[model samples]
Every structure is written in C-alpha cells, then in structure tokens.
Target: MRIETLGINHSAQEFLAEQNITKLYPPQADAVKAGLLEGQNILVAAPTASGKTLIAMLAMMEFLSTKQGKIVYLTPLRALASEKFSEFKKMEKLDFGRRIKAAISTGDFDSVDKESENADIVVLTNEKMDSLIRHGAEWVDKIGLVIADEVHLIGDKDRGPTLEVVLTKLKELPAKPQIVGLSATITNSNELAEWLGCKLVSSDWRPVPLAEGVFDGGTILWNNGDSDEIESSIRGPPIDLCLDTIKKGGQSLVFAETRTRSASLAAKGSDAVFKFLSDSEKKYLEEISQKILDNNEHTDLIKTLSSLLKKGVGFHHAGLNQNCREIVETEFRNGKIKLLASTPTLAAGVNLPARRVIISSIVRYDVKAGANKPISILEYKQLCGRAGRPQYDKFGEAIIVGNANSSDLTEYYINGTPEPIESQLADDKALRIHILSHIVSNPGIKGEEILGFFQKTLAGLQIRKNTLSFSIEIAKKFLLRENLIVQKAERFAATEFGKKVSMLYIDPITAIYFKRGLEAVSENNAHTFGFLHLVSSCEEFFPKFSLRNKDYETLSTLIENKSSELIEPISEYDCNRSLLALHSWISESSEIHLSDNLGIESGDMHRMVETADWLVYCLYELAKLAERADLLEELSTLRKRISYGIKQELVELVQIRGIGRVRARKLYDHGIRTVSDLQQIPVNKLAEIDKIGPTIADNIKSQLKKVR
Candidate 1:
C-alpha cells in the first residue's frame, strides 16, 4: 500500500518514502487496512526500521484528524522519544478539529516546559507517562490513542514494571484510548498480543531481504539458501571476518560483548578506514583526537568515535556519556557512519537502520558465571533484527563473524528462537512503593477496591481475578501487619508516619531500615553508605566472608582501607552489584581471571554499571525527599554532576540554572565565587556561560538583587 493512501499521512512519511520507503510492507499495510479508525488495539511485530514507526504515525495522524482526541506515543528510551519528537515536529499540519499541540514530554529536567495537557500529540517515555499519571498530570484525560513503540520492553526488569503498570493504568482510564504496540519480530507475538489484549499482526517480510552469512578467516561465506544449517557450515577468522563484510561495501553494525571491548574494536576498525575522509573532515577529526587528553569521558568517547568517523565507524555503549552516544547515533543514522560497534543494549530498542549486522562475538559475559557465555537466543534475534532497513537495503545481511568457533554463533542464530517474555513482577521495591501509594491514595478503599486496581495490571490480566483478589488480600494483611498502613474499624488512612513513608518514595522495608538507622546509628558516612549499599543490594549481597565467594573479602578489605574507589553507594535495588562490578572492571589490572572465580561476564558487569546508574538516581531522589530546600538544591547539583560527570557550564545550568559548576568554579578560581559573583560580574559575562538563557540570566540578576 502507498504510504500516501493513509488520509492523514504527513509529508514526513512522503519524505521518508522518497528517501527509500515508497511502499509499505505487508504488515504495515495490514495495520492500515485493519480498520484502525475504530480506535482498536493493534500489535505490530516486524523487523526494526521496517516502516513500523511510519505505520504508527499514520495511525496516529488518522486518529487526530478523524477522532476528537489526542495521541500519546510512548517509547522505552528518552533518546528515542526525543528523536521521534524531532521527527514528528516536521509535519505540515495536524488537525484534531480543534486546537492542536504537538510536544515531547519525557519528563527530563528540561521537560519542565512540557505542556501535555494541551498537546494533540505527545511523544514520551514509559517512565514519563508513569510519572505524569502518578503526579496527576491533568492532560492525561485528552489522550485518545497511545502508541507503545517497542512494547517488547515489557520484559525489561528495571523498567518493565513501570510500563506494565502504566498500561494497566491506561486501561482503567475512563476514556480507554486505543493501543498500538510496535516491536521487532519476536518468537511469541501471539502471547504478547493476548497479554496486551490486542489483535496480533506479525510478519517477517523486510522491505530488504536479509541475507544470513558467516565470515571465516578472510572469506565471506554466503548463505547457501539454507539458513537452518549455516551455523555448522561456517567457521571464520575473528575480527577480520567482519572487516571482510565492511570491505564489501555493506555498512555493518557489530555487537560486541562489552563496552571496553567495543571501544577497543572501533578504535582499531576506524583507524583502518580513517584515510577515506576529505582534508577538512580530517582536520575536524584531528580536533577530536586532540581533545581526548581532557579528563572528561565525553572527550575520550569523541576520540574513540573519531576513529569510526575517519573510517565511517562508531561505537555505542551505556558507558559513553549520553551526549556522546547521541552524537554517534545521529551520525550513524544519517549513513555517515559505515560501521558501529555497540553493546547489546542497543539491540533492546533503538532504531538505527543498518545495511548489515554482524555478531562479532557471541560469547557475552554473565556476572553470575563471571565468564563469557553465549548470547541468549532472544538477544541474538533482537541484534539480528537490525540487519535490514526496510527502505534502504535491497537485502540486509546478518553475519555471525567469529574465529574458528563461528559454528557457535551460527548455531545460536539459526536455531535460536526468541525467548518467552517473562513477567518480572517480582517483589520489587519500586512496585512495593507503588502499591503503598495506591493504598494511601484510595484511603478507606480496601480489599475489592484495591484488588480491582491490581486486576487491571499485566500481572492481573495474566492471572485470574480471584487469584489477584486473594493476592491483594494477602498483600493488605502483610502491609497492615508490618504497619505500612493502619486500618481502624471501617476506615483507613495512612498514619502520620505512613504519610511520611509514602512521601519518601521508598520501599516499606527500606523505610524500616532507615528508621532503624535513625535509632541505632549516628549521621555518619559508615551509617549512611553502609545502609544505602545494603538497601541497594536487595537482590543479592554475599555475607561478609567465610571463604566462599572470596570476593567478599576483597570488598571488605577495600571498605576497610577506605579505598578512594568506593564512592557513596547509591541506595537502590541494584546498586550493590553495580558498585562491585564497577570496582572489579576498573580496579587494578589483574591476570587473575574473574571468570574463573566469580563467574561474572564483562557484559553482565556493564549491565551492573547501568543498573547502578539508575540506583544512583533513585538515591538522589531519596536524598531530595527532605523538606530542607538548601539540601535539595545541593542534591540537584550533585545529580547534574552525575549526569555530565563534569563541572562544565552545562552541568552548572543543570545544577542551578543561569550558573553551573564550571562558571561557579571559574568564579571560585578567580576568587569571585557564590551568588555574590553574579552581583560582581557584568551581566554579559554571566550570559557568556553555557546554557544561560535570558530568563535564567534575568533570574540570576534578580537573585543577586535580593542577596545585595
């Protein structure tokens, strides 16, 4: 079907199609033809960049034109949300038979300006959506359609709970907006469809036929038409095999097992391609090269990325600061990047179209095994799904490039079926906090009232109503028995202490620990960091040493030595593992193989870092829960430090608008510091600082007036 056939299809679709997408894939056509006009739920499962987003936008535009409501496009990643926001803003017109506003609300610190209430369309992340609902964002009522782009993220443990709860909450919304779930092809689309209570529309037809292959040594082994047996047939050289694919003129995405490893490969691979650029490009590249001497991670990343740029290559991993990652991704998507070395998280849900995807290493490190294990079937499929861009490549090539053991990669890719999406609705701290909020909010509303709410959850939908009712009753009893809430006769209101607990946004168990600390411990570093680390490591924390798990002794010795490497452990569910992994990964170089001892892999260690990041954020929020405005301000400043890992003006802008740590430090260095600096410096000089907008500048000046 012609993309133009959709009555509300924007010119952007035309622009995208003009670039390559002239026709819709069968699944996309099926979606448009499925009478989506009636506002029904539709699940679309196809390869990445296979016009799924176009289909979503078409459906959204149609709803906006014909229906009297708003559209909410939800993404798993804030970056993706921002990208799509920019993409959709290019539309010429959007009429909802009324005032139409289009905006992005991922609820980042910058999203303070977002006005979701008036938007005809709002692009945001699932977490932002959850926050809006939790905070009672009033505009949620106008929502008419919701597109869960990358709905498959429902399996993500850290984030999946929020998405599931958000969707369940949406289902309970009085309006019950239409649901559109988009994902790459997975093994269990039918089950996901049922879970979502939507009609299943699954297809594997890529606009580009994806050719499977394996590169052994220097030879590129073509798919002999038997994808089923390719694993056994091909054995190749290590990194060189993938280089062969790139030399053949096909841009390749190489999925590495670890971030440091990805950076290492991109550094080498890019140098191989660096001489291809013009002199001006080379000069710009040289600037990036020189900048790596700076202490900033972003600078180091740019240096790493410059190698890719010289050779049309890029590397992406969570460890790269957000700003650097965005630069690499944007450049790569523009086809300026011929090769991208990335970690598996990229496979989770970022839509960067690639001509071919090479599984450079199938052995991903597992933290538990403390060694490189084969990648999961589900993850391999997700990575391979990136192989073809529906509009660009005539046929996408997915090659598992390896040394002589290429058979392992082939075996996994060929026979690998995507894993079943597991329900991670475990006894999570986040979930506990949410449940408590529900109880407190409804007040006096008990048993069936609360059970009704739970039943609407993905867990409730998957389980029987009676089972949920029983579970809710048990949870309620557990809460009361534990004093998370108190019931009096026929009414219930959170006790004054309970209200404070809710305000703190912590799990009841964590709150109990805090209360215990308040009684038994002084306000000191050992008390604070120890309790924080313990709470953060709720998933697992080995007992403090008895010979088994000898790493415990290392952890203790480091703690005892007051090692500068140990920062304040963030208080969150995953912080413990994260801190340990980070210390291990970054600690003194060791020949003593961690794989043999801890059985943890580098990828698993990387994941711990990511999880620790989120934990740090949660801890920051907890620290901010206090009513002390000064302390909260300090906490915000520290958060900025974490976000940028620098004392730059941008970090300062985030810390406290109009002035950031850099400018503040400059003032400090100059012996002209604090709010008093603004009182002393010329307004123009203040404005010279990064991210200091006019409003902020004016505010700073006003603040100085009060200080004076």
Candidate 2:
C-alpha cells in the first residue's frame, strides 16, 4: 500500500507524501495489484473519499514518466474540471525535470484550442472533449490515457450519451490508449468493465465511516438497530437536525429538493446558527456577506442569501452567480459556516463535504411528470457520500427527515444497492447529433460501418442487436431527410452543410430550424424580432419563458404586431415571452431591468442571452451557406447587436476595444455615434462621460488610431 511500492517515480512519491497520501486505501491497492502501473485499463468503482483521485493520479504519473503523449482528464462539470486543473498544475513544481503544462477547455466551444494540443496534461468537460473530436483536433489520436471522472453519469439523460460516445470514439483510435473510469459504486461495474475491456476494482471502503439513519419524532433510528434522541430547538425537521449537529460542534450540509426550499431552510436555521458564532466570527461573516452583494443589484433572492450568511449559514443552487457560489463554498470548506443548505447541484461533484448531511426530503418535482417523484438510489447515495470528508470527521452522519413513508425510504436508500448505470445513448435526439458528428469527422466511414461503430458502445451492448440496429437506422434516416447526411450507393457522407453544422457544435435540429427560417425570409421581411423568434423557437434555446397572467396582454400585443414577419407563427405564450425578452435585451436593457419586468433571475437572463448569441452566430453561418445575400447583412448586424446587447446603430462602436454597450450608448447620446466621431474627440473630453475613465478613453483612442 506504500506509494513507493507502486512503481511510481521517486519524485511522484515525494509529491504524494507532501499531499499526506503516502498510503493507499484498500481499493487503490487492489488497482495497483491489478497492473494499473503497467498501463492496464481500469474501472474503479468505490465509495466517495476512498482515494479514487489519487489512484488515477498514480496511473497518469507513471504513464507520463515513460511516455511522450498527453493525459486527457475528462470531467462531467466545469467546476470539477477547474478543480482538477489546479491540482495537476502542482505537478509542475515537483522535481520531475520536465515541463508539465496543464490546460483546461470547457465552455469555449467556438474557439479552436491549439494550446491543449501541446499540453502534457489536459483537463476538459465531456462536452468540450466531444466537440474537439468533432472538430478533428489532431492531438486526440496521440492521447496516451483518458481519465473519466464521475463515469457513472453514463446513465444521465442529458449528458451521459456524450460521455459514452466519447469513450467509444477514443477506444476506436489506432493508438488504443489506456482508459481509467472513476465512478461511484454501482450495481453493474463488471458489465461496464467488460464493455470497456478493462479490469474492475469495486469496493465499499471509506476512509471515514458513514452512519445512515432516519429521523422521526425527535429520534433518529440508526441502521445498526441503535437510536439517538435529538432535542428540537427549531420548528421544522430540517432546522431541528441542523441545530442538533451544530450543538455537537460539527458543520452540517442540508440537502433540499428545490432552490426555494434550500433558501427557506437556511433562513429558518440561521436563528439557531447565530447562537454559535463569536463576535469575530460574526464580523467575518458580515464581510463575506458584503462580498456576495458587492456590485450587484439588490434582488429579493440576493437579500435572503446575504441575510443567511450574516448568521454563518448560506444556500447554494444554480440561481446564484458563479462568484457567489465560490465564496460560499470556500467559506464552508474553511469551517466558518455552521450549516449550508443546497440543492442537488453540489452533489453532482464539487468536493464540498461536511461532518453531517441532512436530507430534507427524498422527493423532487419532476417537470416532465408534472408531479413530485422519489429520487433514484444512485442520486441518494451521491448525496450521502458528501457526509464524510477525509481528514475531518471520525464518522460522518447522514440523517433523513422521516415522514409517513420512512420505512420505504430506509429500505430503498439506506439499505439498498445502487441501480445499474444504463446507457442513455439509445435516445433519438442523442443519436442524431452524435451520429452526424461521427460521420462528419470521419469522412472515410461508410454506411455499412456506421452500425459496426455503434456496436462498440454501451448502448449497443445493452440493447438487443435488432433493436440497436433499428434505432441506428431510424437516426440515419432522419439525418438524411434533414439533408445533414447523404447516401451514394453503399457509402454515407456528410453534406457541406452538415460538416459546417457539426463543426459549429450545435444540435442538428437547431440547424434545421435556421435553414427553414432563412428559406422563408425575404429581403423586405427581415427584421430583428423575426430572427430572435427563430432562434428562441429552436430546441437548443427552449423552455424560454413562463408566461404569467399579467404579462399575457403585453406579449399578445407584441406577437400581433410582428405576425407577418415571424418565421414560425407565435402561437404559444412562452414563445412570445421569449421574443419580448430578447427584444428588450438587444434594445440595451440592463439585467436588473429585465429581472424586474420579465420576472427572470439574473442567472437565467445571462443563460438566455448566451444561448441566443450562439444561435444567432449559427444562423449567420447558415445564411452564408444558403447564399442569401439579402439576409447576410441583416444577420451580421443582428449578430453584433446580440453579442454586445446593443441597438443596431451601436454595433460598429461596440466592436472596438474598451467600448461596451453602455459606453456605446453614452457616445451615441453625446452625438459621437461612430468610430469617426470617436477619433475626432479628445481623450480628456471622452473621459468626462459617466462611467468612462481616463485609461479606457486612452485605450479607445489607441484602437481607433490603429483602425485608421
């Protein structure tokens, strides 16, 4: 179990010792004994905080010591990618005597990442890695190893197919690099290992013991047939449990089923939490609370979160901005926060563990089902794994708030096996997008070879052969009907349009929407609202806006006025609301203004704007392919306007460095509407405008001089 006994270099051993990781856990030792250091493919399915990360690091380090190829580490989330990137960067400081450059690529989908190609270790999200492969990054074939973190997400509906297909594609490479899949303990680890042709290492070993139980009527009955009496100091069960944990001088993580519940529980528990904070701690928490509210408009949600933070409690969910989330996570990790309430997003993978984990409810609202549904055992296990932090608690506690269905919960989650991870690649939409990507990227692949390629996938292995073939054929036919794929005798090929769509990293359905919308446009009917409606109607940018009764009159009026120019008739209220939001956004409305008027949060508004901008750029690219000269100029103008959230007249000025939507509007108001106007103005006079500083003015002048 010693680090030096695993065939790792001495420098790597020293690095591991510095990290206090000189001894390996049982599962890690099992992996090493199975020839992991000899470049064997491995699938390690173990409990959380069981040294899985270090096991993968050992393989990567040993491989890099003798090989001259890149180590591509793929994660499921951008936050996890960033965490791994920072960890790998520390290898550069080790005495390895080589430059170990590390790079990360996640959300920058449109850019050609040439830097990651030359890196010794590259960290990327699964989607980013798939896009890079579709764009045919030359370095992919030279990858020596791929470490798939959170590999159990292969069962996820939205993201699993991408991870499954990426692994299949990598396996097909001529180099045949080793793969290390790190996953939570699932029921079918051996099946997954057989699919990947790797050895399996499955264990339930935890560095810190986990005690799971159900709490009902001020008493928690442990799974070991023992019980503890919890004195309630708060009204709700969640706060009561939180107060119990805090009384024992341990931090607690409360998992709620929704964002609203998370915030409400945190606020309710803050009263009891405040009793534990010292004056100095209260002052520090106030400073952190101010940091969360700095430079942001005071919305109701921000106010609630800030108030909770003052009592050393915070809530986390997708609604908060990334900066606020980072601050809360750092504070909680530093042991400053007593109780942190959050939705299941933190359970996905962020390394924020605590001494106690309280599950407020096991049921979540299923949007598709239109009812509250119980969570899967895999998900419950993921949440429970956050209870024990290595190097922290001796034994972590996971307490579920019990109700009438407490027995079912205990039988299903506490004493149950995790479900087998089934491949979601069988979904039609997933297959359509990835099939086009594969054919477009590999021109030599023929129609006959398509099904053969898929047969190597987990989906192909799980489903019946005939069922898999039928699904593939259906997807292929759909792609051909949409003109994304063409068939000539026995060969299948991607059209020029299909190649562009694949490289653009958009759904094939989005491309079809653009094509139909562009074909219906005439020179006179082209307008900003028409194009905005087109992009918003696509599948990629949907679930656009929820229409309230009060806003229906306004949205209906806008839809009626633009009825003639819209590509698709605005029949749904949500569609109309989407157009109105985009219209306001491009009209240079502030985020706070949109939040107040449209009932959208700042995070939701930002996501909508980003998706719209990317779709507009795709529409512009499609216009070029369609050879519609009339639509080209309008699309270009709209693209720029959407990119900067500005009016059409401000597009040119917004393109200049140091000039944003606000500055462009200010210049326009002052009768300096164009670059020529900027060139003629003195720097000192330009600095006199509101919010424009002298340095920005100088930079604008410098950019204008270069333009001239």
Candidate 3:
C-alpha cells in the first residue's frame, strides 16, 4: 500500500517519502485496514523490522491532525526511549496538518515536567509515566494517543507489572486516549487485545525474512532445509560462525545467557575476528578502542573490552556503562564491528540488529529456581527477531548452538508457538507498590475502590477474581502495616509521609526501612559506612550481585567489625555485595579495586552507584520527614560522595558541575577544595591543571561566579 494513498495528510506522507518509505509493510497495511488511523485501539503483533513503529506514527499524525493533545509513546527501557525519541524527532518536520513537537522524559527523577506537556508527542519509560501520574502532572489529561513499543513486556516478571498498571491507568483516564501496542508475535494475542480493547493486527510479516536453524559441531541445519557446514575451530562453533558470517560480509550477534559468558565468548572470538578486519577498520577500531580506555576508568574489564574492540569484537550486558554500550551499539549498527556478543538486552527493544544471530545457549540459569530453565519460545523468538535488518540483508539467519538433535531443535524453537502474554500484576511486590500508588493518586480511595482498581488491571481480567482479591487484601495489609496508609471512616488516605513516599516513587517497604534506620541513627552513633549500608540495604537495589562463597568472608568481616554502627540487622536479602561495593566506592576506590576485591563489573558498579545515589536521596527525604535534622548534613554529604564516588573531603568541591572525582581530587591537591576555593583561582591558572581544559576551567569559574 502506498503511503500517499493512506490519507494521513501530505506532511506525514512527504516526510515518509523523504525517508524513502513510500509503501507500507503488509502488517502495517492490515493495521490501517483495522481503522488504526480512525483512532481505534490496536495491537500489532508481528516480527521485527515489520513497520510497527511506522504504524504508530500514522496513528499519531492522524490523531493530532484533528485532536488537541499529546501522544505519549512509552517504552520499556531507557535506551529504547532514546531510540524512539530520536526517531520521533523527524516528525517535527511534518508541517502538512499540524506542526509536530516531540520531547523525551526517561530520567529516574521526580518532576511534574511542565515544559514537556506542550509537546505534541512525549516519549517516556513506563516507570517515568507511572511517576508522572503519581506526581499528578497537569498533562495527564492532555494525552490523546499512547504508543507502547514492546508491549509484550507486560509478561516480563520484573518490568511487566509496572507496564500493566500504567496501561490500566491510561485506560481509566478521563481523556479515553486511543492506544497503539506493538509487540513481537505472541500466541495469545486475543487475550492482550481484549484487555486493551484493541483490534488485533497480527502477522508473520518481516521486511527481511528470517531463517531459523541450529548449529551442531560443524553443521548448521536451517529450518528452510538448507544446510551449511564449516571446519570447526578449536575455539568452538561460535567463533567458527563468526568467521563464516564475516566471510559472507555479514555480522553475527551471539546471545549468551549471562554477562560473564558473553564477555568470555567475545574474548574467544576476538583472535579469529581480528584476521578478517581490513587495515582501515582495524585503525578505526584501534582509535575508538583507545577513546574507550581513555574515556572510562582503566579497569581490567575496560582494558579487556577495549582490546577486543581492536579485534573487531564487542560484548554488551547491563554490566557495561551507558557510554560504552552506546559505542558498541553505534559501531555495530555501522557494521564496523563484525561480531557482537550480548545477553538478551537486545530483546528489550534495542535497535542493534545483525545479519545473523547465534544463540550460544538454549537454557539460562534461574537464580530463584536454582536451576537452568529452557528458554521460552517467546524469548527465543525475540532473540531471533534481531536476526534481520532492513535494506542490509536479503534475509536474516538465526542459529542456535545446542546439543539437541536437528529435528528437536526445529520443533522447539523454529516452529514452536510463542508463549502467551500473562499479567504479572498479582506479584506481591507489584501489588504492594501499585496499591499504594492508587490510594495516593486517588486520595481517599476506599478499600473497595482499591479492589476496583485491580479489577481494571490485566490481572483482574485474566486471573481468578477471588485470587486477585486475595492478593489485593494482602497488599493493603502490607501498606497499612508499613504505616503508608491509614483507614478513616471506611476510606483510605495516604498519610503525609505516605504521600511523600508515593511521590518519591519508592517501594512502601523501602520507606519503612528508611524510617527505622533514621530513628536508629538518631538515637545512636554511626559512620558513613553504616549510612551507606542503610541505603544499599533497601528494597530498591537492582543490578545487585549475589554474595558468592568468595564474597562471604570479606562481607562477614565487615559486618563483624561494624556491627555496632550498622542500623539494619543484616539478612540474606539485605544485599551485602552492594553495601561493600558502595562503601568502597564512596571511599574513592578505583574501578579496578572494586572489580578485583568485590567481583563487580564496572558497569554493574556504576549501576549500583546510581541505585544507591537515588536511595540515599530517598533516605534524606525520609530523614527530613522523620525530623532527624542532625542526619541531614550527613546525608547531603553522603549523597554527593556516592554520586561522584569520592570522599567526604571532596564532596564540597564535587558540587561544582563538570568536576567529577578525579578532577575534584586534582583541585583538592592544588589547594582548591570547594566552590569558595575555586573563586580564588583564574580560569587560565585552573586550565593549567591536568585534565581540566580551557573550556572546563571557564565552566568552573562561570559556575562560581553565578553562585557569587
């Protein structure tokens, strides 16, 4: 179907033409036929690279042409939000119907975001949207259309419940904005569509067809009845496949079950991938390799990743920092890096696709189950969905490295139907969090009203009503026991503290922990480690490492030595690894020290630091509310030190923007220890300091001048 014939307005059509999108994919055509442009709700379940995003844009432009509000595009990840935000920026040039403006809000900060309310389209992460609803943003009612990319994530155990609740809230909004859900193919599309009130536009269409297969020893038996063989390298089949893809002038994406495994696979493939790199690519990779090393802390992990990039290989996981992840993604997208190893982060809507995808394992370790679980067909399909990239390959290939016989592999993964999308809203933690949020947002919501809110949730529709009601009662009891809500005359109202906790977007349980810890410190003596440990021990800690056998003695020694100073009694879920890591971090330990001593990857350390920084701020808020005024200065100092990974002495100096730990320490050594100290130096003199260039020096002085 020609884009011009869709009657979506001339400006949108011309913009599509400018991008050479003259015709629609068949799935997109079906979506249009389902009255997508007429503002009806839709659920588009199709393969990757199948024009789902284009369909969402069509709905947005069509709705905005006649409506008077914003389009909220929600994603499941920060990177995906950024990707969609960048893509939506092009629509700003569409001047045919109404002028388009787009803004992105994905920060894990609390704000009403009044400025973003004016945008025609606002892109956000699910958590950010939920936070906005809690903060009661004025533009809540102004949303006219919602585009939920990766809508299938409603089945994800960790993120699914939040997305489910957010969608339910949007549906219950007075504006009654239309919803457009895009998902990879799932078996139970009817269930999801029914919950969303959607016209299910499901298909197997892809711009680049995919061939699913399995790799055994030296043979790749494609489900299309095509077999390919390679002389296997001692480094194993993953490396051989990397070489084979490179020989065909295509790239390979190797999916491992763990971060350490991904890194190990990349390292194993590095030597083989090196010989295929041309002189020019090698030189470019070497250049950026050094930039990566210079730009990040020179840890052994960074050095290993940097060295691998020189060999035209890269690995990605949550353990790598955002800057490093961006480098790998950008270079991979540009085809500079031929072989990429990653965990399933790609399956969460990252746009980094490859000509071929190699699944390094058919099973992943489940920590809770204490066993390795087979990959669900939905997960397998998601990993395979990245095999194709439009306009680059005639078709994409997905190969699984498995011990299963060819037929078994084909039956299980290649021809298997994906699992159904089920609601995770009944989870105790999810229920506890959302139930509090509902009462806080609705203020004076009754017990029945809270149950009513659950009825509107996906769980309410699918799970047994009695079962769902039981979960709600338990969640309400938790909220009441934590003192986050109070019963008054058969209705519930969030106490002032409860309202603050909800607005801060923290778990109700975490708030209780913070309050208890603050009262403990107020009545006793504690050090920075204890305070840091208190924040790290919260329920909000993510990307946290388990306390391994090796970690036991080290953490036990610390706990034994600091038992008097510690606020919360240590427990298994208290997260000893985070306590030690962040304690070491605020003491100015190097990244290598963290990795060597704590077994933490630099990426995970940074993530832990980010999580701790936010929780510490949450601690500060709770302390203020609890009237522990003395702890405020300590918390303020602790927050800055954790954020910059610096010490108390450098905390004041680090307050000056653009001056991180190293620079702050440098200035400290030069007798510049605070903003007041910075005022005494000239820009040129400060510029003479190592690593502080003229621009940064000027920035420092300009900041001090503004403060003055």
What TM-score would each prediction reach against the true structure?
0.76, 0.96, 0.96
Compared with the true structure, all predictions reach lDDT values of 0.61, 0.86, 0.86
lDDT of 3 by residue, 372-401 (tens): 999899989989888977878998989998
lDDT ranking, high to low: 2, 3, 1
lDDT of 2 by residue, 330-421 (tens): 99998889999999989996899998899999899887798999899999999999997777689888988999666777888999999999
| Cα RMSDs, all models | 7.1, 2.0, 2.1
Error of 2 at 285 (Å): 1.4
Q: Between 1 and 2, whose TM-score is larger?
A: 2
Report how far off residue 72 is in candidate 2 (Å).
0.7
Question: Which pairs of residues clash in candidate 2, taking residues 3 or more apart in a chain or in different chains?
Answer: none
How many residue pairs clash in each candidate at the backbone level?
20, 0, 1
Cα lDDT, model 1, residue 58: 71
lDDT for model 3: 0.86
